[model samples]
Target chain A: MGARRETILETIQQYVDLVATGSSADVVALYADGATVEDPVGSEVRTTREQIAEFYGALDGLEQSARLLHTRIAGNEAAFAFELVTKAGEQTYTLAPIDVMTFDDDGRILSMRAFWSGEDMLVS
Target chain B: MGARRETILETIQQYVDLVATGSSADVVALYADGATVEDPVGSEVRTTREQIAEFYGALDGLEQSARLLHTRIAGNEAAFAFELVTKAGEQTYTLAPIDVMTFDDDGRILSMRAFWSGEDMLVS
Candidate 1:
């Protein structure tokens, strides 16, 4: 269980690192095959490893950062609440981001579901 | 376990109903003693039952609504993902709200922690 917790932490750290460094490939590599991401309104976009990489690369200068508020783990899954903010040119924006992650027995992320404000992002 | 799940669901439904009906005292009655509510930045405000009632009264017609996206239960606990929106006259707001609930053996809410954006509310 300790190892599982550590792996979950490492997975989150790696995701953050990829965001900070603008490494789309590295970020996509963290997801398990057949993973699906959902927006706060329940719409989801499912993708494979390569598609996730392309999705990340499609954005330009997407500098995003988040402060994790809490993480609760139960068995092979974890739920995280975070305050996410982004910057593009002269505009700054903020949103509430919650990530639900499911890890396989080996501790790799088997699924990742993200919840965020799409309307806020669109208007911002 | 099924009874437990039903009780948990009803708790959440009652919360939503309180918000829509603007019944501050009704909402406060749902919390257990020593309940804590945390913002996305991790700052928490702990209040007793009467204090929670007063807190609700402090707001003027605070109309809020939420759509449950998904709910996952583990034993006596549950985690819910919801899309929360609020309307104050001419203004509209949306948030990604995640609720973590711990229930006592009696099926009453022992604790509830809410995650939302403080900055967005301030700015809006």
Candidate 2:
């Protein structure tokens, strides 16, 4: 991989690490001012920074964790597939999602879209 | 990886190979009867086998090729990121896309969604 591609992958890995660690603020900080996020593909896009932060914040109470399975980077875009597990009450839920992200020149995310459907979620 | 996961990856690799070889019929055969395809994320979803076949057929003239970059499989779902290059006239275009596919119990594809934007395309 080229240095630029390596850098983009590193940035994405950092974002994933923040998500796994429940660092909502750090996750939000990775986005550009006008960045947009659309989780689950067909959802409404969150445009403002505050909205984006709130979106990540919602996961803070879930005791969420993630494991990266694969990653690919090209230009300023990177996509990865990972498993996300969250504990809520007495139940645990698992989801496998593929997240595609585009970064600005400064390595801040311009957009993030996660592809997964309700059927892909497992609860135990 | 389990045997099932390996099989799923093999199926996906076959699908990618067909796309690279311009085997539209083979590509369509990989899908279930009512399989859907949504290319480029927010685009209209193509339902019905004929619609999906026509969609793949549209790429037959492009002299397209694909190089897989990363793949992840969980349950009956698999997602991969790859570079797609096509030659048209005197120009060559390259695009990096992440495709998420769901398979039924029989291993036929139930849906395929490609995540890519116009900005991800490069022409030379």
Model-by-model lDDT, in order?
A: 0.61, 0.79
Q: Which stretches of candidate 2 lie over 4 Å from their true place?
A: A1-14, A17-97, A100-124, B1-3
List of clashing residue pairs for candidate 2: none
Candidate 2 docks with a DockQ of: 0.10
For residue A74, model 1's alpha carbon misses the true position, in angstroms, by 0.9
What are the per-residue Cα lDDT tens digits for candidate 1 across B31-64? 7666655334244455576655676675447667
Clashes by residue pair, model 1: none
- Alpha carbon lDDT of residue B79, candidate 1? 60
User: lDDT tens string, model 2, A38-81?
Assistant: 88665788999888988988877668888887665655666788
- Model 1's C-alpha root-mean-square deviation from the true structure amounts to 12.6
lDDT of 1: 0.61
Model 1 ranges off by over 4 Å: A1-3, A119-124, B1-124
